[model samples]
Target: MAKVIIYPTTSLILADLVDRMGHKALVAPEAVRDRVTNPEIKSPPLNITPEEPKKGLKYAAVDVPSGIRGRMALIGPLIEEADAGIILDDPGVLTGCAGCNRTNELVRLLIKTKGIPVLDLKYPRDDTEARGFVARIKAFLEGLK
Candidate 1:
């Protein structure tokens, strides 16, 4: 079975979907806040934070949802080391997505498994968009097999 890692919101939607399909969808224990911004990122929120830098370097990891953080930081790496990795996370920065984001705070660090692939889901958070998102994920899983 392919190891599917999804965003927290997406993870809730697909919780039963993965089980019904007999694939393991790991909803892990870490939070979205854990995917904190590294000091190197020169962007706002991450960059604008008032945290002091330690010799020009600041460790700004924060607490996020348990769903996406554990997968990106823990499960994704594990899958890569043994089996192939299939990461499923929302590409959008909005929608109150409680997980690792495009600024790639955590994904950049752990996604080293060569065969692993990270699929950024595209949709409008509407019915049609949701269907399209599922369809895209199905296609992605098919490609892995």
Candidate 2:
């Protein structure tokens, strides 16, 4: 099974779709779950502790833009662990959070750099589109397997 990274990482639709297609979703919500709710662990970018601010800077320490380092801290690991991806680019969703654009871009870039098979798609607006979306995703996952 491929470990696919689903962007907007909190997207339940993509997560469910990935699972239904028989793949592992390295979603942000699942990855950061313990860190966010568990008091012992400090979440970065999302819920940074005093010490985590400087952490994970190396991921974005290069010629990339600033402010993204913190966001990368959370995403970098998941991307590193992923073998494939499915991105739902829905402009109607306001393009996700503010910094997410940069983070998402970086994730896609990294996925490309890693030479993984990534399926990029627009969020379905209707039942037909939704069915097409599922078919496309299933095809992608099957190809990986």
Candidate 3:
């Protein structure tokens, strides 16, 4: 099954759709869970290792903000590992938000340039549009080998 990175990295609906389509959803909670549950990581609450920022350097410059670097550290690897992606633009408040514009832009750029099949869609404003949104996603997922 394809490993699909759903943008916003926090959209449960997209993740659920990917999962239901027989593909793996690479989302933030799973990434954080890996770090938090790792025996090698002694840090709690913050759940970040010193090397986390360093790993992020592969994606962002040293001059970038630590927050962006830290976030990239968690998300960069996911982008690299993604076999496909789904991005929803201008998402509604209840949908999901990356909370960092720089990181969001960087993530979108990374996913788009990843040389994988990516479904880029705009957030639906009405029920009809929502159905079309889901249908498009379903078709995309089903098209993946």
On lDDT, the candidate that comes out on top is: 3
RMSD of each: 10.2, 3.0, 1.2
> For model 3, what is the error of residue 122's alpha carbon versus the real structure, in angstroms, after optimal superposition?
0.8
Model 3 agreement with the true structure over 1-145: per-residue lDDT tens digits? 9999999898999999999999999998888888888887789965897788788899999998878888888899899899999999777767776678899889999999989999999998899999999999999999998
Give all candidates' CA lDDT scores: 0.46, 0.72, 0.89
Q: Provide the TM-score for each candidate, comma-separated.
A: 0.46, 0.79, 0.94
TM-score of 1: 0.46
| TM-score: model 2 vs. ground truth | 0.79
Candidate closest to the true structure, highest TM-score: 3
Query: Once model 2 is optimally superposed onto the true structure by TM-score, how far is the C-alpha of residue 105 displaced, in angstroms?
Result: 2.2
